[model samples]
Target: MKGVLVLENGSRFSGELIGCVRKGYGEVVFHTGMTGYQEILTDPSYAEQIVVMTYPLIGNYGINGDDFEAKRPWLTGFVTGETCDFPSHFRQEQTLDQYLSEQGIVGLTGVNTRSLVKMIREEGSLKGYILPANLLADGEKFDFPALPRDLVRRVSTKQTYQHSVQGESHVVLVDFGAKENIAGALTRLGCRVTVVPADTEFEQIARLQPDGIMLSNGPGDPADCADLLPLIKRLATAYPLFGICLGHQLLAMSFGATTEKMRFGHRGSNHPVQDLRSGKVWITSQNHSYSVRREGFPAELVVTHKHVNDDSIEGVAHSVLPAFSVQFHPEACPGPQDAEALFHRFLALMNERKGSQLVTTI
Candidate 1:
């Protein structure tokens, strides 16, 4: 069926419908990665959003069984310049079109994605709808739904789950629409991972006897989770903590820092981030619409890393507390894995803390 993307600002773009033939609506944003369509699609952070792929040709390698970051795709719609129907990869299990159609996901193809991305860059991400061209051309008045404030609640797990690695150290992960690889990465580092709901209380966490706490990446404005900040501050004080993406923003917010939405957020695989302490730069995978503000940066925290492109705060560490965070994903699924070593960094911090406790007891 023919379809058109109707933006709230009266912008309309037409394309061919590929998947489930129903209208799709949500915040429309673009990603600049050349691959990792599967990871991008399944990431819970993309919940209630319509993703536009900037790369001209996507799904060339096909979808594999191992690459999904979540059990299901959370983005409301998928938009691309062209989607491959016949992908060529040894591990390929299904084509992108077949998977999208099977999953009841609505996708628009043969779109002028470059033009669409250019508009988004200038005007910022917008809430929009993908409907049949006829329905749009026929002058039907449709009320687009406002972006929901409870995106994190919708995507977060209702129950705590364990991904046991049988390692000596235990890390409790506070899920805020977390990606699967966040747990996978931790387990691979020889850490037993326990995942809890976003609303899990600190007392509940204290019972888990975690050596460290990991604040997973999530969606929506960090400020919307004002209630979580108190718990986050409490967690940081008691445990060696690490935060990623949304977690990074919340960690800063918990320490008197502020956050603001980017005009066009970072949503790609090759973002360059510089480590200020080491003068090292790493190509990172990032997907978020908000960042910690430099204006009211908390005195208790020190800037550790920054984005090379925009000078946005990328990493921070608390001076007194053994807590740190990074705005880019260290557990990149279909992207770079260099930052995966950050998990070991967290483990070392946990070990150091454990040694200190043993000494105190002695």
Candidate 2:
């Protein structure tokens, strides 16, 4: 079967269908990670988007059940320069094509993925459609799926859930399509985590009496999630608060800060960021198309980290509050660990707060 990718700009590319033979449409984006295709595919951050892998070959190790970041692959479509037909790895359970098809994901191979990536790099992200070239070549207009405005709602869990461990501090996690590592990292740090839905009410969350709260990374436009800002504002003052990625954006907004979309956005593992306070540079992993607008930040909040590439804000801290956030992934599952200590930083803040509260009670 033939696969054709039609960009919103009307550019088209032809390739061979390798996974589920079905039409799909989404905002086309590319990832530069040479590894972690499975993690990227299942990452809810990719929800409602079509992903083009920049690496020439994919699925050399096949797919395993243990590495999924989301419930399933949320990407609307997949494209690759070449795909491995046979994979050899001890953990391999299924081939990439088999895995994607089983999950009802559409994939295209034998396409110039490098060229596609370059196009996205130059033009920024855009909506596109994928279908059989035979169906597209004759000038038939394929109806593109309505670009989703509520991507976060579609990806977020409807009900609250929990991940518990025997620990001193109880952390209430506001799940805005959180990555698994966020909870896993907390568990490793001697914290009991209760994962809640994105729209969890403040009164209900307060009843948990958690020592801290975490705003999680998620997909889509931050402005689309206006419903969460009030809840975040209410929770921030109730406990020690920390956020990451979309969580970071929401935190900024809760303090009356603004956000803006990037030209191409950061979506790779090799991004360089500098801790403004420590003057230390760290290679980090990042994956968000929008950023908190520096101009919109309140004076009460201080910029703590910045992207060395474009001089964009990477981290922020409140002047008189035990609240902070970073726009990068510190719990990177398939990327660099330079930012892993950030999880420790959040844990330390919680520990400090617990001590202060104990002292006050006495």
Candidate 3:
């Protein structure tokens, strides 16, 4: 079946519909990852956007249940240059088209995805729609549902949840729409995890007596979550705090720092980031359109990492607090292992803090 993707800026692309033959609307963005389409599609962070994969061929390895970061697909649509019809990986369970179509998610194949990516890079993420002409007319602009401004709220867990409480080290994950693999990463590092909603009360965590608190990656403008700043500020004072992606932005906000939207959001598996403390560079997986502004950061909060390409603030740690946050994902689901060591770093911090607390108590 044929489908038409109409952008708010009036650009249209026609392609073969491979996924659901349903109409959908969302903010259109692009990712440059060579692999991991399944993980990307299922990541809760991409909740309100249509993803365009810049890679020429997708789904070569096929889809499997194991790689999904969330329980289901969250995106408005998917546009790809090419989508594999027959997959070859041993773990492959189904083709990309079959999986998406079953989920009722729209997907467009054989699109000039490179051109779409270029447009997003130049014009930033924009609202768009995907639909069949029977349900919607081609090139006709409908009152496309607004791309959610409160993306974090839409994706965040409604109630506090827990997993793997059997481990020795107790960690409370403040789920600002955290990806599931992040919890898996922490469990692998010996953390007994208690996952909570984004605006969870600090007293609730105090009752649990956790050893560390993790601020998780999420979506939308950080300013919308202003109510969460007080909770983050209170929790960071009592325990080691580690943050990723949108969690990083909120941490900065909690510490009198500011965040701003980027011209074009970073949404790929291979972004280069530099560790300011070690002078080392690592390829990172990133998916955020906002970043912490160095100029607005408080003097006590020091920048710990920077983007190699644009020198944007990639990570920050407080000078006097056992708190830190990174703009890139360390729990790479569909990306390289170059940044995965950060999980060990968090584990080390937890160990060191526990040892110090024991000594003080003794």
Candidate 4:
């Protein structure tokens, strides 16, 4: 079977089909990681997006049971220059073709990925469609619609649920298309996690009596989620809060900061970020297309981390509230673990608050 990727700008790239032969459409974005295809494929943050893998060879190690970042794949489609049909790994259970087919994801291979990535870098992310090559016409016009703003609601847990019940500190995780690793990291730190929907009410969360609030990474433009800013601001004042990726942008905007779209955005595992306070650098895993802007900055929030490449803001902390946020994935499901210590810091804040509350009640 053959397929073609048609971008909204009328750019078309032809390739052979490797997985489920069907049409897929959504925003077209790219990832720069050399490996970790499994985790990227299953990440909820890629929902409503067709992912172009910049790495030439994908699925060389194939798919394994342990590496999925979510229960299922959320990306609209997958593309690559080469798809490895035969993989060699001790833990490998299936080939890339088999995994994509099983997950019902459109897989197109043998395309000029470098040229495609260059177009994306120059023109920015574009909406696209993966269709059978036979569907092409002599002249085709493609118009891309705005992606739905309810992506968080579509991907979040419809009902609140507990990931685990055995831990000292209680954390209510606001699911803005959260990855499984976020909860896993907290559970490993002895925190009982209660996963809640993005639209969950503040009164409902207060009933849970959480020690801290964890705003999860999500997809799309941060401005589209402006409705949540007030809730985030309230949460910060009430509990120790840590935000990641989309959550990071939302947290900053709640404090009068703004966000802007990047040219192509960071979607790699090797992004470098420096802690401004410590003057220490760490390699981080990142997957977002929007970032907190630096112009007309808010004074109450301090810049705690910065991107080593373009000097973009990577993290921020409220001046008085026990709240902070980072634009990278410290859980490191598909990247380095250098920033994993941030989780420890969050737990420490929760513990400190608990001690203060105990003293006040006495």
Q: Report clash pairs, candidate 1.
A: none
lDDT of 3 by residue, 234-350 (tens): 888889889999888998899899988898889998899999988998888999988998786799899999999999999999899889989999988444585777777777778
lDDT by candidate, in order shown? 0.91, 0.86, 0.86, 0.91
The lDDT leader among the candidates is: 4
Cα error, residue 55 of model 1, in Å, equals 0.4
> Looking at candidate 4, what is the lDDT of residue 304?
98
Winning model by TM-score: 1
Clashing pairs in 2: none
Indicate whether candidate 1 or candidate 4 has the larger TM-score: 1
Model 2 misplaced stretches (Cα beyond 4 Å): 143-146, 333-336
- Candidate 4, residues 1-362, lDDT tens digits: the string is 88899998988999998788998899899999999889899998999899999999998998899988888888989999998888999999999999989999998999999999999999999999998887776455567888777677778888999998989999999999898989999999999999999989899999999999999998778887889899999999999999999999999999999999998899998888999999998888999988899997799999999999999999999999999999999998444566888899999999999999999999
By lDDT, the better pick of 2 and 4 is: 4
Lowest lDDT block of 10, candidate 2 = 333-342
In the range 1-362, model 2's lDDT, one tens digit per residue, is 88889887878888998778888888888888888888888889888888888889999999997888887878889999999999999999999999988999899999998788888889999888778777765878755656778677777778877787678889988888888878888888888999888888899999888989999999999999987898888888878899999999999998999999998789877788999988988887788999988785799889999999899999988898889999988888445576777777777888898898889999
Give all TM-scores, in the order shown: 0.97, 0.96, 0.95, 0.96
Provide the global lDDT of candidate 3 against the true structure: 0.86
List where candidate 3 sits over 4 angstroms from the true fold. 134-139, 333-336
